[model samples]
Target: MTLKESSGVDNELNKGDRLDVPFPSICFFDLYTLKVFHVLKLAEGQYITTFALNKDNTNLLVSTADKQLIIYTDPALSLKVVNHMLKLGWEGDGLSPLIN
Candidate 1:
């Protein structure tokens, strides 16, 4: 299980974070302790061919032997509130006409 074929983004990230592409699953792990934090199982017969992380280590792009490219993002780093609805907006009255 070596990543020599990887694009080497993992070499630039924090030493604590890494991914393990075992048969049928991708595992999230702490490289220091070799502890697996999470395991994402792929479709029953799928396996990974290679993977790379973004420059800042917030995104993972995986190439599968099954002819698929899967992208995994770090939610806290990759997500934003693109749009939000204020709970107190529009409906100003506590009572509605339907209540009558």
Candidate 2:
């Protein structure tokens, strides 16, 4: 989808007091490949407060309103972290190994 369409879908998904709805995962689009290369779900019930990528694009920083900051050195590692969190039944407040 185009950026505009993606934004619209995101807004719709976030609308209302839908506490039961799990928050969408974070996804990174690869411009060169013209596709999504990574996705991770880090928090629930909190919007992302900050997202930053290092100058070399080798590191990523994501912060949520729940006072959690996750630093990802690479997409593969990030996917692994998110999957581990899910398997452990993370509820958005627990300490995570990925947190920095």
Candidate 3:
């Protein structure tokens, strides 16, 4: 669950931004605290293929092959975009065009 701790790892999360890493794993860090917050398990039987960041750098977009797209937004803000996506028929494929 935990990734190797190194300067490289820090580089991945330096700006509190989103990144699409191919590895089937994820690492969490606290921006304000600069601490290792979590080492989470990847979704069961689902390999993460790509990810993206909202323009404001407050939310994260994650994609998986299980026909799912997940959005992680700042808890303080309302999750309107995600709700809208759900409201519409926009499935996870909508994000494919934006991944590259």
Compute each candidate's TM-score over C-alphas.
0.51, 0.44, 0.42
Q: Of 2 and 3, which scores higher on lDDT? A: 2
By TM-score, the best candidate is 1
Say which prediction, candidate 1 or candidate 3, comes out ahead on TM-score.
1
lDDT-sorted candidate list, best first: 2, 1, 3
- Model 3 pairs whose backbones collide: none
lDDT (Cα) of model 1: 0.67
* lDDT tens per residue, model 1, 47-99: 78899987877778989888999998857554231111122233334522233
lDDT of each: 0.67, 0.70, 0.66
> Which segments of model 1 are wrong by more than 4 Å?
1-23, 80-100
- Tell me the deviation in Å of residue 60 in model 2: 0.4
lDDT of 3 by residue, 1-100 (tens): 3453643477556566655443566678799976766654566756677888888888788888787887776665655666566667566955422232
Show model 2 residue runs off by greater than 4 Å.
Answer: 1-22, 32-34, 75-100
Off by over 4 Å in 3: 1-25, 30-35, 39-41, 79-100
Poorest lDDT segment (10 consecutive residues) of candidate 1: 79-88
